[model samples]
Target: MLEHNDEIRRVKISVRPLVEYVYSSGDIESGFRSVAALHEGTRIHQQVQRMYQEGDLKEVTLKTEMLYADILYQIEGRCDGLILLEDGWMVDEIKSTSSDICFMEEGYPVHWAQAQIYAYIVAKEQGLSQMKIQLTYIQVVSGEVKKFVKSVTFSELESFVWGILASYNPFASLRLDHIRRRDDSIRSMPFPFDSYREGQRKLAGAVYQTVKEGQKLFVKAPTGIGKTVSTLFPSVKAIGEGLLQQLFYLTARTTTRTAAEHALGMMQSKGLHLQAVTLTAKEKICFQEKVSCKKEDCPFADGYYDRINVGIMDMLSNETLMDRTVIEHYARKHQLCPFEFSLDAAYAADAVICDYNYVFDPRVSLKRLFEERKKKTVLLVDEAHNLVDRGREIFSATLGKAEFLELQRGYKGKNNRIHETSRVVNQYFITLKKECGEIKRKLWKELPEELINKLDLFVQEAEQELQGIGHGDAESRQLLLNTYFAAQHMIRISKLYDERYVTYAEVVRNGVSIRMFCMDPSFLLAQAGKGFRSTIFFSATLSPLQYYRDMLGAGEDDYSLSVASPFHREQLDVRIEPLSTRYRDRESTKGSLVRLLSKMVRERQGNYLIFFPSYQYLQDVYDHFSAENSDLATIVQGTGMTEEEREAFLASFRSDNPDTLVGFAVLGGIFSEGIDLQGDRLNGVAVVGVGLPQLGMERDLMKDYFNHIGKNGYDYAYVYPGMNKVQQAGGRLIRSEHDTGILMLVDDRFLQRQYQELLPEEWKE
Candidate 1:
């Protein structure tokens, strides 16, 4: 399917990536990752810019393109600042560093390359004979500033630009060739599926239009509608039409990520030759048992940068569906770090299948991804309802007193810096604990800047200790790594702290811990997608669309669609059993719930799933059910089931499954939602209780916070979210029109008008 054309297409690449690919050279090693560990000087940049005179521009945008042997290279970028000089104009390149200014005396070759390209572009456009290029390095730790200037004639700038282009041209030409072939296949490839079934066509159409219009769309296309392909196919078609350059199918769970990979594989088999790369988590994807990045520990990590480019080129040239296995194959082949290799391959990929955190998380989101690419990229957020809670978790940060106390004790006398910094942080918690002795819990409307400042000092020391990690044992390095990430996370979260965030500290019997909790993740979630071309938030049950719209920060102009269930309501035999399943009544009603579940499964002999609000409640009911109905084959969901165990569990359900199995699963857990069991494999689903979350401080805080903002606090904090889990569990049944099943709503609250209003159109009584 991947065939070369006689002529190559123009590949649009910005200056950052261009210079990085051409001029940068090093082994693939992580730098001191802590944002505060270095003097990034975001504040200093603005402060320095203020000193510039009028007519001098800060953040100047520049563009230039050149054609080389059959390849058109489009290069554009924004310079940090452009100053007006008496002779002409000066290209100001600002860089923040943590090291001493003396090391920066000659300036980095990459920095010079970047500045020279800007100089060349400006000189060529303004018809100038010469230009002054200045490199300003701001030391983040000391706030010390160093400036270097170089004067070059137009001919000198042109020669330097040409030399870099010669190095970059091969990579560009390779990509250009691939794009031409990829576009041809995309333009000619027919719909992979024989046809769209049910409301699949409608879902696909809405997604295509949304991407074309450059807007966000919230789609409520239920399960069994082929949601993955329905969204992917149209987006792939858009790429062929030259409306898009890349697509990111962001998923929340591994099951859904696999589903995306399978969808792309299906298309590829049908003649689609697009490069779709899947990013597995670093910890899981690592080839080593432990992630020790030292050269002595890992061969793949040692010379990663030395081999990564060749690995990327080889992998991209051959593979279309670059899933974890494919990525690992090439990673091992080239002796490159598998995780970092996947990230590099991802930037070059036409489509990326990765987790939501890669795009939205504040601490770990890909930093090198520029806004220009985002302008041509579309985000397909699969199982979007999960993003609400997941977003809350991603944006939240908690620090326990025990971690710092442990570090203080462990590092004492050995590393004075780590010990002193840890002791200071530990002392801060000790003082705060006395103030809250009576309640043991305190809340703050503002972020604790003093604590953050202390953590910043701690991170600085932690990074230093970690640089000598190989000198210590694995445990020591692991401890240092954990604390470093924690401190860095706290710093990152502090920067994003606004009115939507609340800081809380609670002292338990064991230890004291403080948290910066995101009461509403809407603003931060919206902020994460600041530059993306468009986003499509789709799931089988995005019920109460308004709640999702409000919480996901959907604009008024954004599109929303509610596709009718393709299957007839007749296929689902719905029942509303009025019984008390609230936490208060769960104890007394446990036996009755077991009997009801037994009765429902006894009436029909096929696979069934019974969902409860909590695992303890589920276990209690499961214990009673097993006592009474031991004859039926049964499986109970466990806590944190591994990938193999989960697959074997799902594999237990099949069309040829001999027994009428009754699987007891907790609501909102893995099996309760994402997994599918179509046709005779699944016969019924009984969702016990109203699915309200356990009453906790965090939930209460969210409730009170929402109430203060004139919204329905209880519903926002508990009811709707709980019911979303209930609906997802129920949705597992009646996946296809041919599949007939019974759906029983076991909670008395379900019959209430307020709760009934939240039910799906087909499920409501």
Candidate 2:
């Protein structure tokens, strides 16, 4: 909700969330929800609306403001129909559900409350003495309808709405009070740091200007220039100035999340009273060893809605920075799902620290952000370079024949519809496999419409089967649910397919796999980022600023700012070994690479990190380095390392270490970006390659597509992405002005004009 006035403190909210919050109850339904689009319900609504007589109005807008507890709430909503009765007008609210209409009986109380609220607004606005309210429920599939009607005087409607507002008063009061305090603090707060570093004020000014003008800003700020605080400080000030309501600090890695949190905490220590929530991934935060949201298996998920409001109120009232630890603590105290609890709290927060998926990914995005709220919210995307690949991943979808084949076999006698649909989908894949016999790969510019239709039927049947399955049949239910989600993703992506998408089929021994690969996600990214007040994309390695701006969907009028490194050239000892670390030359050059790494570590009696393009290369070189040194302290980053392991790896590079320590990690792995090891903590960084991604069909397809579009095909496909990893890896060194570290680039390609031009000015002689 946005505060519309300064003298009286007016809060604006729509009717749906306002009523649902007060009426929402029952267990958390974390099962397979029907993925039917909302537009289906709208179509049904229009179908019902078309049946009304001539004088009745459809989709009528109603709004009213009520004074409660010294705060004015502007409530507004669109009634489905306003029918002219013989005596007066009746507010008709239409709802569509997938369930049987026969079970609706008198209809839900929330539905009645919503209709009555609209009636209250209408009656109050038009000076009507009384109004009739109707709740109309229709079955989505069968088109069966049920209607429940009630007549209430204006006084009764007024009393009911007052009660609703009373129930919502506690939450509203907290928000109003917090906003007052947060704004006051922001007005009086000084910079968290004693002084801004070089280029910090310039970046911060650019961010503030962008938010002020409601435009996007792309920033190429260096690592040590305090990008996190620089961006966040201005957004916070914007919230205070009433230019924005909230901001989302979006990042791709856990370490960057920590940086944002730290920045917020620094401000909080300086008297800021903003409420910020950090959303953690469900799999990581789930209390269960295995994430099963069934009520019988997880107490935290049972009756979650009943407890969630109270829990959120308590948490928000007491805590300001509700990160994972604080959220988990409150969740346990209230026996609520931590993931859902965090999301609930996030909706009311002044700042949300979360992943890019929450705003960009269609499947998992926070759908509750209404259009009005978005016009006042800003997105500060940290490590914006990572969104290029992350965008590709979120927009793409893949389905294999194995799951459908298993379903066809397993559910043969259990459910014939599931079996038949799965069989049809499986047959489609089999035919595709036969067509790609020798080539083993097939590509198409158009979507696989035939396969998509089959998958849709399969998904519908799987959803019904899942809903009907007993709790004891968890195994079969799990399989059906998994395949249902896959099919849902495929169907969803199919709707987004355009000239930028490519449908590809691959055949292997066991089965055939098909993918709807998103070749250019810029358009989709722009669509997702629309409606927000502004977006700030900042990173240390957003080199080739034009490329990032283009790939990130920057508008022609959007501003781009590049800040110079705060650290001097003398602080970085950069050396190029001019060695070939390409795929084919690895074996022949392994010994030389090992010798160079050993010599660097031997000369520098401090902590060092050597980054390779792949784990295979890391392991191979580590084998030789270990055999040759035999006395060095080394820690190698493993595949899928746990949180504790990653923390321990960073903790190993102690400032007071007795001997030299070297950590071998992959270039784009967790160790590459967002980790800070200042001064003696990290003395040197050795990058073994130019960080080109392995050659593959996807790369080739991307190359061919970009070439066809007249861009530099090779650079767009491989060099840009690869060099980004190298830059991120090298950025780990010289984190602050006081830090001076050696950086070695072992790839021969670094001397080339194309690659040398990509290097940061401070990294070159």
Candidate 3:
């Protein structure tokens, strides 16, 4: 929807990010700042706009084009109100704040700057020699209003607008140059691979055509068909053709993010000049041992905005690929928070590789992506099978009574308001526990209005405390902050709750817990993906296409493609052990399962990965197998392995190893999918049991909910998800055409009609 002109080298930007960037100064905000909820803010805006005069225009769409530094800038925005003043036109900008407006004698520079831009645009277009600008501030809770007005000549307005443009021109120019050269390279570049491996061309063509038409494409691509490149290549071509300005390669796991980065690297080596940024989670990339955003506590958070533009310019000018290492280098060089720096850099990147949370999670999604940019953006969701569960997590939230109880005690003598609010919340939990009596666990179709009201009050008190009314110790402060975030998240999710959601309460050892569980996330996912030009959800394990389509919010007009496996069927030697590895039979069959794994490894004489349904099962069999074999080389996956430990585990599976190496892992784990160990590095894989999820309240709720909606509830909640993991684990073997490996499916369920039908075509006889 942006007015982009390739010939004119025009840069289209919204009014907000531009002004914020130009006026951005000082430190990254400290941990606690009062941010009104989105809906609350919108309500306040409408409340103010309702007072407009008969001739005054509210939500006025204003736009103007300016030539600055020989680059065209198409700036557009909706002004809060264009007042019909007695003297002339007055451009109004409304801002809602939690703080009192009485102390704010004048308005913020950023607010004034925004009003001035709208005024200038209106003045230039209407042939007015003068214009009035107004800053309307309303205190959110009290509904108190404060207004500041200024009048400037048309020449003065023009000068001010030009200065704003000049400050932003450098960034726009940098992006413009990158796009020009990137497109040039893309126009001449061929596919990165030597040739399309069977289904690759079809997938690539489908992606390109889907993007061109601005629709969604769901793909069930088999493993080893170059799914990454097949998707990325066509998206890159779309960028070259001006069909898209940016693409987000969203993955469910860190390993898959690496795959996307590697795919882009492959294209870059072939002269593709696109600028791509890989965003690592903040916890993994922060320079400090403990992440404290307080300016005094962390050097990187101090005056980050002051140095960020320079850092971004330096990185973009010198490097085309801004991965973690490159980002950290520039971040340290410029004294910037690496995570924040990457986000800033990503705004200008042609492609962004990051986790699905960054794009889909409401609490974490980037707010700076304006509607215009979104209309030109595409989301390529990788390993999409993981998104079903991830989507549920994204739209759900939990609140525990323990945090409130702790806060109630911590703040009792220090602050009465926080103490009282926390006590009230804790007391509500106690009463809810009494209501449950013996059952302990309860579910409801409606929201808990009373708890929500109490949590809202607690959130307000907590926010005031965090704003420095009364200070607490570091530990107390952390607990309060964590509780504040949880309360806010719960409130946010409550707003999204509908018939597809359920409210559940469970009593724990010490206290009670409640969660707003999103039983089906299809509606929310569809809402989140609305503005994008196109979305391509592809995974090697996105089997049972219709099930995924319904769960992933597929539209009626959306296209679905099921690409056949590019690898030959003869390459895989499949076998069914026909053993009982179910939960009830696990102890009875542990010995037989151990022997089967030992025999497979001994027979193959190459590296083999054995996957179990859970860590306990993996350990049980590993203990028995080790007791019998003793001399066999083995490594077992530990719980919560660090990145270095994981690397060491995989590195042990080198192709040059002299003897056979067997790795014990769990299905649907970090090792099960998104890993590539082609050729001699991995020669066999054995998946024990049908990878069914542990039976739980949430899964049962999902099954019941889906069945109520006239679908196979058990399959929707259990069977399909379990089999997806089996497919993903088996997929690790035979990554390429030349690769050959043995696949062993342990458990009698593998031979069952239901499970057999769920297996991938290549895995079936």
Local accuracy of candidate 1 as per-residue lDDT tens digits, 277-334: 9999988999989876767678887767667678888988788899888999999898
Lowest lDDT 10-mer window, candidate 1? 1-10
How much is the lDDT of residue 169 in candidate 3?
85
Poorest 10 consecutive residues by lDDT, candidate 3: 1-10
**Arranged by lDDT, best first:** 2, 3, 1
Better of 1 and 3 by lDDT: 3
Q: Write the per-residue lDDT of candidate 2 for residues 499-550, one digit (tens) a residue.
A: 8899889987767999999988998999999999999999998979988887
| Native-referenced Cα lDDT, model 1 | 0.85
Output the TM-score of candidate 1. Answer: 0.93
TM-scores, in order shown? 0.93, 0.97, 0.98
Candidate 1: list runs displaced more than 4 Å: 1-8, 36-39, 46-58, 81-92, 102-105, 122-134, 146-156, 463-477
Model 2 scores worst on lDDT over the 10 consecutive residues at: 464-473
- The sequence of per-residue lDDT tens digits that candidate 3 reaches over residues 1-765 is 222345677877778888998998889866665656464678988998899879999999999988887787888999999999887799989998776567788999989998999999999999999999999888776678999998999999999989998898887877777777888999998998888999999999999999999999999999999899999999999998989989999998888888888889999889899889999988899999998998989999999888888898899999988899999999999999999999999888899999898889987798788887899999999999889899999999999899888989988788888899999999999988888778898888999889989988887777667766456788888899988988988888888989999998998776799989999999999999999999999999888999999999999999999999988889999999999987999898887888888888998578999999999888888888989989889999999999999999999999999999999999999999999999999999999989999999999999999999999999999999999999999999999889998999998988889999999998888
Count of clashing residue pairs in every prediction: 3, 0, 0
